[model samples]
Target: MRRRAVVAAAAVLTGGVAVLLGVAVPQAQAAEVSYATRCIPPSGIGLPPVDGTTKVEITAPAAAKVGDTVDVVWTFTQAASRNPDIIDLPADSVQPSGTLKAAGAQSADIAMRGPRQNPPVPKGGAMVLSAMKGSLKLTTAGQVMLTPDAYVVNALSTDTSCAPTQQVQPAATITVTAGSGSSSGGTGEPSHTGTPSHTPTKTTSPSPPASTSTSPSPSGGSGGQTDFTGKVVNVPYTCQSPIGQKRATSPVQINARKNGGSYDLTVQFKKSVMDSPIDIPANSVKPAMQVVLGGADKGSVAVEGPKNAAPIKQGAPIEIPDLTGVYKPGATGEATLSPGVLTIDALGTRTTCTPDSSTVSLTLDTTEQAGGASGATGGSGSSSSTAGGASTSGGLAETGAGDHATLKALGLVAGTAVLLGAAVFTYLPGRRRTR
Candidate 1:
């Protein structure tokens, strides 16, 4: 079988801020440029992986709505720490570049906007969210799918894009998988870990909504619960990507072992990643990982499936790759599952593989309508009750919740003062929050 090489066209990034932010719609005020790269499985022909034994990881929500503030993090590994002190490799030396295209090509587009921060060049370890804080905004609700034509471009000099001994992984894609559901949270500066914490500091963007968003009721689980103590399992996952252009799925292998109270998560990809490796730049770095966990059982039980979806649920630890160790494996996914029940347990194991900010949620799609479950799929069933977490306010992802509610209270105070001087007028402060 003749392998086809996936190539990249290095074009001067255009459109200025408007294009960069994807603010092509009338609703958008501003936008920012987002990053992307193409990483095909080793079976498929593509660019070789980076030489530094590095991996580039990008994280964002599985689904977003119009006016939603989506937080995007792109992590890279830096060489500043390994060989310290004197200036060696310069900054912005390595770029995993690409263009973002939404599925169905709606009239509106997803804008990459606001307060973009440069990730710190770590002296050692992996560089995280503090590294790249790119916010995503949807202009059209109809735009559900996203595909980025990702490719790498190294600025350093070399006879070719690769060196004789550098490790190389093929450019993979960053896509929205599983159900297209949105999440709610506050924004924060990304660090070398790329993980978003519970309560992040405030950003210039608008605050999160007062009420949390909810999602579909937690449904039945496909069976396969495992106690992955010193074991490895090859898990098959299905996601929608490469839309008409390319369709591929990496063979996933999960390596888990009990570590004291929690299970350690390690993963490997068969015939995946850049075939070999590429040269590592002077001071730049690649991603190690950003782990994602979800489902109703947050213990040693890991729910493995698509985003906003679940066909299989079992006991296993989750993992996100990082630059802290040799990231030889291919790559994992970000937005491929649904909002069942999720929590991070990466208290130990790897340091840089922090809990990722990627989130999926279940909403109050229905209530007990004085009737029992219809006992039918997609029916008016009473059993499929959604435990509400749906966000009422149209807040941005990663932004702390409740601030919008606080702002609403303040607005109410002002209204109350005016009402006292006149009639007893009723007001709903947070009504206008969700766009």
Candidate 2:
């Protein structure tokens, strides 16, 4: 009886430690970083003080429900002094945009544009640049996993004419409160099938602290058993640049996977760092970037058990293991995640990629059609319907691999403790009886 009691106590203690490490490490250590854009006015030493003030006001519904189509708009009123060629605010950085239709109040002098022809936006919309007031509208109609999130819309000025730019002080704040309705198109409480307490909040604000509360489930993947093969991710980029189409770099395939099942997927990925020059049109007043990330890496993410699937109900975050970031110089003279890693938005070219093993090969196929260059100078203006590549700061929260290893080490310690207790209990009592 005493031996049995001893074994039981140790087992409980070890199990407790195992569970605690698994829960606490990931929840506490995962980087809760948020990134955003800050515009800077030009500072000239010898030239005239070309002071420009660009004020932005966001008009959005205080709260929105999933499935309900709504319009979230941004109104930009540029001061008379500044002639900004491109004003960028990432739509996803602001809120959970569904069918967003962002537009800039049509302008005669400045046309909306980006560094790459196609900027990254989940919901399709064009960010435009006009001299006066321009607007951007996005929708969160069908997305279900939204929660109460505060958005910080950073104002960015990327003009060849703005010569030198600096960070805008006191960034604007916007709140998007997630409410539950219809499982279909109505709003309701956030589903909590053990979903993360802190949702993705990078670029604008630090993610909320995760609940220390634990809710463990049995060893079984969630329902909706689906097997996806060759889940190739396609990260959105210009695919072709505006100024130099032929000079455009190729798309780097950072990661790829083939789902064995929901939780049992096999993945191959790489993480490399590189520095390249930012693109600038010849006629545009802006100069090329000083340095940008340019390189490739090897190795991918590691997956733990109990996986979930798409349209994942019950509120758990869709964690794509092995999260990483691609650092680059921002439009406003700052370093930010050009293509943030491990985010639902950065989930990559989720549109069923080209089937193949591990290898990235593609040319800079210039999608640069005939269009007017944006600057303070003269040119014929043309409009396109794609998201321009002028990136405003944005980011995604991620739990690093080191955190995962710590949890595993704790589990191993617990398992060893349990075994040691059982062995000692059996041998010591038996030896006493024999003596």
Please provide TM-scores, in order, for all candidate models, with all chains considered together. Answer: 0.19, 0.17
Candidate 1 TM-score, C-alpha based: 0.19
- Candidate lDDT (C-alpha), each: 0.24, 0.21
RMSD of 1: 30.0
lDDT digits (tens) for residues 285-381 of candidate 2: 1001101111221112222212122222212222223322211111111111112111111111110111111222111111111231112111111
Lowest-sum lDDT 10-residue window in model 1: 344-353
lDDT of 1: 0.24
Q: What is the lDDT for 172 in model 2?
A: 22
Question: Which segments of model 1 are wrong by more than 4 Å?
Answer: 1-56, 76-87, 90-97, 104-137, 152-435
For model 2, give the 10-residue run with minimal summed lDDT: 406-415
Candidate 2 lDDT score relative to the true structure: 0.21
